[model samples]
Target: EETDFEKTIVDSLNIGFIPNFLNSFLDVLSTASIGLFSVLFISFFFLKDSNLLQSGILAFVSSDSEKRTVHSIDKINNLLSRYFVGLLLQIFILFVIYTITLFIVGIENAIVIAFLCALFNIIPYIGPIIGAVIMVVLTMTSNLGMDFSTVILPKAGYVLIGLAVGQLIDNFFSQPLIFSNSVKSHPLEIFLIIIIAGLLFGVVGMVVAVPGYTAIKVILKEFLSENKLVKSLTKSL
Candidate 1:
């Protein structure tokens, strides 16, 4: 029966699957490559002639506001660049921690799994939970043949523990530093913004909250430099 079942599964998979998958994969790869090359070409020119673009944008503003607009643009650029770099660094740190921990716990494809989980950290609050679920599923499937008591539960538990540890490090250390330093917001302020955004718009809101908050703060500081609340909130910016 087992052999028959295996053959049936194999036959099913063989029925036009490989060709269809290969064709779709090739199409996706071609499209992605084209898009990537286009972006690179445009970015190269943009970087080379950034001043021209800046001057053109400033030309639209009245002469009196041009200086303030330039300052605002510079501040926004600096803050966003640092914020993105900090996020990248956070992901790298998480990837390293996860890879080492999962490998130590004997999970299959630990490096790839870690990389994926780390990338998911780009989405705030909910992303780590999703990554952990994926890790557990992968680990359980890898150990499918093992006895449930002796091998499966214990190994899965160990993997979960490792993930929890990595998350702790990320939450307590990496995140605070990124929010406080990159966006120049107090950790508490960032925490509140994320919570409010999550409540209002779910995961998408949480993901954009920090960048949006930073941009708003910059603009407010530029225009409302004398307002007391704005003065306090945007002091760091």
Candidate 2:
């Protein structure tokens, strides 16, 4: 299964995406074996360590900033813990979020549809979009998967609203709390970085853009920040 998956990845890689894809695939393989669980766990770890490195750096600053950094780190740890545990609650939460959304928007079978999408949310960038695509396809293809229009409308509405709100919350709040608070890049800057990543390596690149950039930033801060040439260049520039 792993070999086949890797072959498919390698086979599909275009000349431009090949290098980035190779780097990402190798990094993923090194951290853990090729599987959904391993990949997801590594993604979660990337989110966690990104903050840990920042808090560690804060230790180098003056007393007050360092102290606040401590508080921030604690808050971050709490956030990571909550996010980590959220997996268990995902099904219930997705059902509720989507069910309510459908009820308001007038779709039916909200609970069932949303439960499925919650599963997809586990996959990062591809997940939510896929969920929507599946939902819409089902909407068009299937017979409401129910008897009553009222029930069906609420069900469908729930998925759409649930997904929209969930995505919005993630984009505006959860993402910063998890993957981005550590990086401190502005929204515009982050957008530009995503655009660059997308241009270079497609959807997966865009999704992992923030973390990859954060990782590079952390490495530079930790190792290159003190280099004589870096200091001279900084002063000169």
Candidate 3:
């Protein structure tokens, strides 16, 4: 019965599936490569001549607000630098924990798997779930051709538990500390901002939420210090 069901499903798949998938993959790869090169080129120039970039940006500001704008830019730079460094630290912590967990579970290529999974955690909100899925799939596949119920299931379950533990540490300890120290926002505040940004602008919005929110808060405080809401929100900055 199971063999018949499997064969039926296989037969139902479109004959062009493999070719279509290859075409789509190549298209995506080309797009990604172009985007990556563009970003790197721009970023190289920006970093190499940041003062020139800053001067160009400040050229649009009125003389009256020039000083304030400069201050806001500096503040934003400092906060974002710290936030990015904190992210690196977070990834490192996750890598260490994941490597240890995978090693204990006897998974093959544990270091590489842990590193890839750790990198995925950079995406806000949804990244960890994606990482967990990848980890479990990799763990199970490491024992390919083994007995599924006795070996693969138990190993995958252990990997899942380890992922939960790592995430708990990240949630309860790492993230809160990073948010408070680097961005000067509460975890709940950041969480709500990410969710709202995700709803309004999708994954890109969520990815940029923390640094974007921090920049906005800095600008608001610099320009609208007297407004009650702005004052309340920017008090942390």
Candidate 4:
């Protein structure tokens, strides 16, 4: 169904975005190399306009059933603001760690790879894995499957180590900072949510699936049945 929908849309538009996506890869790597300043500038310009944020928050908290909607909005805004701050900090930390590791490993094009890894790290679990996979494939394929001990092995090893340590930081600190007090679904549920979203809306949907699921769950918890069964069915860390 989604394939059909996507095809129809593409056919109607007579456009393919695959090249657009691929063509932007170099530009993306270049932007990443600019370090924390670029990301901070982006967040500041796009997200720091408090007026739009306030209005959006007001609309969400003022859902049809809310009574103390205004108060709720304030609290929710506070929580989200804190989460946003923490997310930026986490990204910065990951960027610094990867960049330092790259330097330590003496990889020639390490800055570009580290930047790519840091940028991709924004997506949490899948992001790091994807980055690691890409690096491994590049290491293997670029050298024509050369002897690992001579050329590819050390690079792949450091990339994996960098990803592993980054994941630890993400799980231990970032998840708690971001998902606390939100609807924390079980791992299976999260996986299913991603699959369903991918089926329905493709790559973009999969990217946003978990957070979207969390929003839906939060709404259900607040307004739907407040039953033990519902809570148990949805519970997870």
TM-scores of the candidates are 0.75, 0.47, 0.81, 0.56
**lDDT value for model 3:** 0.81
Candidate 1, 1-237: lDDT as tens digits: 469889888877755777897687556444433433453355445445757867988989998988888898778767876777788788899899889877877887899999888877766766687678778878888889889899888878988887888889898888888888889999889889989987896565677788779878998999899999999999887
Query: What is every candidate's alpha-carbon RMSD to the true fold?
Result: 7.8, 12.8, 4.6, 11.4
lDDT, candidate 3, residue 83?
80
Candidate 2 has an lDDT of 0.58
Candidate 4: C-alpha lDDT: 0.60
Number of the top-ranking candidate, with lDDT as the measure: 3
- Count of backbone clashes, every candidate in sequence: 0, 17, 0, 0
Residue 69 lDDT, candidate 1, scale 0-100: 82
Q: In model 2, what is the error at residue 58, expressed in angstroms?
A: 23
Q: Which portions of model 3 show Cα errors greater than 4 Å?
A: 1-49
Task: List candidate 2 stretches off by more than 4 Å.
Answer: 1-38, 44-95, 102-116, 119-127, 139-158, 226-237
- For candidate 2, the TM-score is 0.47
User: 1-237 in candidate 2: lDDT tens per residue?
Assistant: 569889999989779887897687556433322233554567677565867666667868787566555555554445445545554455456556766665565446756776776656644555666667666555534545565566555555555666788777666665555443345555666678878876786555654565556545534443466887545422311
TM-score: which is higher, 2 or 3?
3
